[model samples]
Target: MASPIKSYVPYSIFLIALLLRPSSLTTAADFSSSVCSGTLDPSRCFQVIKTIPGGGQAPSLESLCGTAISFSLSKGNQFHSYVQSLAASASNPKLKQVYSSCAENYDDFIGNLQSAQVMLKRQDYNGVSTMASSSMTEVDTCSDSFKEGSVADPSQLIDKNKYYYTLSLIILRISNKLGGAA
Candidate 1:
């Protein structure tokens, strides 16, 4: 007959294994698929996130959002500066008006992104979503200023706006997955 302690040893080991198992173990590719599933352009979303600087390896959703937000903020500021420069240099009154309005709109866009970051820090996912969505809308409002055949369409701005919106959606999805935050 085996000793009582020895008889229980295997069971104890099994129990320990069960308790130590990770609750959610995911590879970078798996995380990408999960995050991109809700987006219109999942491939692009996956590609963008997978290629984040200092983030080739798997990253948690929070880190991914922070990286993407940093990029988006940089682009937003660049667009604003571009508009300001255009406004200052333009001889045409109409062009100056469009550029000035776009500069203001981009200013609001940067503010919205900043507010979204604050909300995310507070774990107020709904507030983050609202601010991010509002930021994207401001991009459209800026683009529309030139849409009456008054000025040429800025394709780069349009593309950047779409990309930022996708990032916002990813952030919203991640927040939602973290439970009831959104």
Candidate 2:
């Protein structure tokens, strides 16, 4: 038979390990809930973070925001390519013009997003917010082109456009929160 002291050895080690773990060690759900609490759409913010592997487990707001920014950048690149294809495939001159214009907007948006990544790396939260806001403006410009007198986007980029705006808005809000955290 095992002695009582020996039987408790493993449990004691477990308890000590738990105690020594840093307070910063947090579950993904907890991280997402706290990060999304003050965002424009907390549900969407949480969902976005969940899409990113290990994003919700970020130890700091800055790192989580970095994940979000990278996600947005990936989407922006995809959207740019799609818009460029739309422009190439468009038969109507006006439609072609509109898509071409949107591609330009995406170019600007992507540039801004890249700058935001740089700012986040430098811990310049304000710069991140500025660039994110610029990105939102670029999306807005792309959207506005659709409304210009029955342009009639056959590709229905508008639906995709909304997500771009929301992602940028999330980045902006998160960066602002990071500013407060600083």
Candidate 3:
């Protein structure tokens, strides 16, 4: 038989190759599904925002929240920058208000997410669930209020609400996955 070192060389090389392989080999479609709740298949990014949780699906809320949190973390500064861009670019006072309100809510969502994460890490399952549920309700209320309000142009508001809703869903999903109530 060959020497022990020679015999192990192939196995070691294979292991090294596996470790060095890239993990982000997903397609745009796959990325969309993971971020946008499988509604991004048609290239309609906004469609992902319109999905509502139903059918007694407990995981829906959690999924939305988790996705939102991920999005915020990945684009927190960029989101703020966009808000500033809107504020500078929009001439309508109502539009400015809409953008400002959305920005504020985005900040609030991020804060709430941080708090929820702490609660989860502390093993405060009840607290985590309670916070997630309350936050989700707030997101719904904000979305409805913006729709009904005389914001003139509500697209920005709607987009912000969608982001918040997604985040709330993600938070709920993670909490439930950690054995907390959805």
Candidate 4:
């Protein structure tokens, strides 16, 4: 027969290992599916979020918010650079003026996103929503510049801006939900 102490030692080690292992918690699929359920493009939302580095396992609401905020910052910076380049390259003074406005608009957009990120970290849902909404308006401001100028809209820029705006909206919505839950 096995000694009682030896039998207990194996069981104790097993219990210790189990206790030390991190909790399964939430998977990325679970989080993305739940988060994207109400969005217009659930699949696109899931794909965009899951593709972020370490985003495939969003263990908490904070993790999801972080990923969204990071993506928004990246997109905002890219848009700012693109508009700056457009302003620099435009030969027509009128077009150059509009592009310069766009560049400034993008600067405001990035500022809003940065504000939203800070609010998110502080768990200030109302502030996050306000900042994100403001960022969306910045995109509209840029688009309207072309409309008011009676020039063709920059389709590519508009599309990309919309995509980034949608991501910000998603983050805002999630933050609101978390606030309500709290």
How large is the C-alpha RMSD of every model relative to the true structure? 4.0, 6.8, 10.9, 6.5
- My TM-score estimates for the predictions, one after another, are 0.72, 0.78, 0.51, 0.75
User: For candidate 3, which ten residues in a row score worst on lDDT?
Assistant: 49-58
Expressed as tens digits, the lDDT of each residue in 68-173 for candidate 4 is: 7788788779878988998898877877888899899889988988888888888887888788778878878887788787765443666666666677666766
Off by over 4 Å in 4: 1-24
Question: What pairs collide in candidate 4?
Answer: none
Q: What would the per-residue lDDT of candidate 2 be over residues 107-170, giving only the tens digit for each residue? A: 9999999999999999999999999999999999998998883688778898788888877877
lDDT score for residue 89 of model 4: 87
Better of 1 and 4 by lDDT: 4
Clash number for every model? 0, 0, 18, 0
RMSD of 2: 6.8
As a whole number from 0 to 100, the lDDT of residue 114 in candidate 4 is: 89
- Candidate 3 lands at a TM-score of 0.51
The local lDDT score (0 to 100) that residue 169 gets in candidate 1 is 62
CA displacement after TM-score superposition, residue 166 of candidate 2 (Å): 1.8
C-alpha local distance difference test of each model: 0.70, 0.84, 0.55, 0.76
Best by lDDT: 2
